[model samples]
Target: MTSRKEHALKRRDLAVNKLTSLGDRIIDDVAKQTVPAIRVPSRGTSNIVYDEDRRYYVLGDRYGQRSLGNVKQIKKIGQMVYMANFCKGLVQTGKTATLREMYYVSEGWDIDFGDQQESNIVGEDLEVTLGITREDLGLMPEEDGASVYGDITLKDDDVEINAMRMGKSGYTISPTIDEVELLDHNVERVIAVETMGMFHRMVQENAYKKFNTLIVGLKGQAARATRRFLKRVNEELGLPVYICNDGDPWGFHIAMVIISGSAKLAHVNHELATPNAKFLGVTASDIVNYDLPTDPLKDIDVLRLKELYKDPRYRDEFWKVEIKKMLKIGKKAEQQSFSKYGLEYVVDTYIPEKLDAL
Candidate 1:
């Protein structure tokens, strides 16, 4: 009598032969145009001997199953097999399946190995599950490739660009503003300005003339660069930095950059952006205090604000006041939306008032 191991191997071979035969027939049919098309198996087809629930085929020491490739990977591998089988059947109708077909059959062995999402350290197949690097799918060669680090070193100018790339889903860094240009050691106050022209004008007008008020331009590359430079400034100068972005989702995101750091660039949180940076202007509270126009607020914004308010990581008294103000206003008032009256209003009232309070 055959040993159980021997029986398993024989069954495995038989199943492989059956799959091989089925693949060959499907290809032949496709080649002959007998059927409109052959749809590749998705998930896994039940093996006759394994029954529906077992979901595995006999291998040397155990059962086997199919690799549930991600939808895209499944299609790619399936199409290749379909084409090969079609051509092979045409060339040699009854010949034994080629090594290519055998390889796919063996690839299916991963199924019988008992590796699944519950037991697996990594997701079932990160490549397939998350649709990330193909190697994560276990389809790529096992050999390790070159390290991710490159020989390229970043210059001062490249930091913003690199940070932007790194922070694709989050806020951009602000440009660097020399505190010395604003004031000398006698500087006492810091102001976070949003617009470049306004910032430049404020600087030119000597708005920050006496105080060390930082006139940050929270728009474009300047803001992004400023975010990065702020780290160095804080470390070197031992001065407190403040934030002043427009009042909008984008603006909120910018503040979040300084306050919490972008998801991918979180490592640079303490290094680039300052967490304690206060929002000095254009807050939800400014709606009533500055008396600005309002836009119809969407539920999404309200929900997002609520979430932000609840976030223990970023929740602060300043944020609480702003969020409550927005809840009271029931609308949004972006600084850019403000007309000349609003702009002047900000320069005249908002800036002056906040400066006094600060």
Candidate 2:
């Protein structure tokens, strides 16, 4: 029942167990496996601060105990000890002297030296393993949902139904229905809705059950990944995708992430590509037809639109037209702006109508 605070205080008061006494045997075992002749080095004359400042050794074990909780003092001593131990370990191990070699050698726990040599050795790979590898480790496994981490391998039989669409750069897919359930074995339509409000409204109106929609909110990289995955579905499974986003620069950017890849994650094109997918709602031209809010369009949005208009990579007629039209209107319209039409507008008018038009 002891709280963290109580446990920490008790630990501080208790006799310190040196690392050598606690787990030195483990390190010795590792050394024996790797280097059977390994031997502990004897103390020698050194210029290290701890070695030179003999006052601490003379002051007994309680030398730095007075300032135990002083963060700055503790950090300073930690840095000196770390650097000395690292150099000594390197010399003894005869490992490579290169930066990358050193990087891999001394990883996992971080050591800060007051400079900006920040390196995360056990980085995303560890995260991926922890999040995704656990499920696959067990011999007799149980059914787990598609989680971010753990080992859940995908098999052909697992995919009940698949659809695909091909476009200029690649392809994309529509969400498949779960065929395992006998009565509910029909193919589902995968709809990409940028706004969560719009998604919620669509769900309330039974858009998923009616059209079998998989409402994905595509903000930033998720949009790009969705697009890339859609493209793959299109190419591999011949599925067509419909995009529903606001009629603005950022929305267009989100759609483009599916159609072509975002600049930052362009390398992910292999997974998702809906090159043939069509943009179906709230275009720059729609501004002229519909009433737009007078709030001056974001300056940065205008700037990005101009960049898109000029960029050769985004030379699609649709992109050029929309970007130029936004520059002309000088206004941005959100999916919520069309809320006056009500949720029925999205379900009865937008969803069915858009797909029929497509």
Candidate 3:
């Protein structure tokens, strides 16, 4: 296994190469008396292509927006240069920075971003331009999400944890998935739960042990580490992956991101997304079939569902039927709604039934 230092050094080299190329381009443009242009992938669905074979989305290099001559392009170039220098400094000093810290660092740049959103856009631009992730540049986002009751041992830096032996409440996953090594695990499948309430209930009920499975709590939208860890577990460990989320548009999106990758993080989709991961229940149909309690679909839920309905990735017949049913019913159900029969129903009945079907 490559040590953290070795990994960091490799990333540093890549960053250096990117900077050198940019500098060379600028020099060449100057020599030719022409505008210096940097091409970056456009950040949207239009620039993202789904790899049906891999079951993940990747950013296409076919079309790129050139940063050249215009005031906006000039400011963007300044931000890129600023970010490159900052990342270089981090690598040289063997230091790490948080996304928030990087945002603050932009305050000292020649170009005023006016807000954190503008600064974040430049950071994303660097990811696309450099073909590297923010994490590769030693920038960490706020840590959220965890795993519990997995028959797996993880070594993060000096800390080693046996996930299953952590009693009822399992270990909090490391913020940096790159830093964590899965020493061993004897599990058949990994179930990523979207809600913490359901996750906690499953752990409390020892659901993982009962089903010989691993449970990962996404909390809501998954963190980079959670997604990366899940991807590694699926790819390296060869575990069947499943996701359980609420029967709503947002929940569906969470599952989609886990399975096909998010457009925003398209550059690192291969490293983080598990395209083969199957979508397990708490589906729109589950509400009616299980007689689970339901809440009226909110305006936001309808809007999100409408958007998802239009997305090409969600055009499957099952998705179409589920979404159509949701729109027709105008209601959504949370995973916790299964608790109406008793919390044990989800672990004892629902999950097992889903596994049998799988």
Q: Which candidate is the best by lDDT?
A: 3
| Whole-model Cα lDDT of every candidate shown, in order | 0.44, 0.44, 0.80
Q: Can you give the TM-score per candidate against the true fold?
A: 0.45, 0.49, 0.89
Arrange candidates by TM-score, descending. 3, 2, 1
Superposition error at 338 for model 3 (Å): 1.4
Residue 312 lDDT, candidate 3, scale 0-100: 71
How many clashing residue pairs appear in each of the predictions shown? 17, 28, 0
Candidate 2 lDDT at 230 equals 51
Off by over 4 Å in 1: 1-186, 200-205, 210-212, 220-224, 336-345
For candidate 3, the 10 contiguous residues with the lowest summed lDDT are 3-12
- What digit string (tens of lDDT, one per residue) describes model 1 on residues 169-272? 21222221211121123344345555555554454444554343544455532233455455444545565666666675556766666655544332223334
Clashes of 3: 0
**Which ranges in model 2 have alpha carbons more than 4 Å from their true place?**
1-185, 209-212, 219-229, 292-294
Worst 10 residues of 2 by lDDT: 132-141
Instruction: Give the TM-score (vs. native) of candidate 3.
Output: 0.89
The alpha-carbon RMSD values of the candidates against the true structure, listed in the order shown, are 19.8, 19.3, 2.5
Candidate 2 lDDT over residue span 114-187, tens digit each: 22242221221211212211111111112211101001112223342221111111122212111111112133
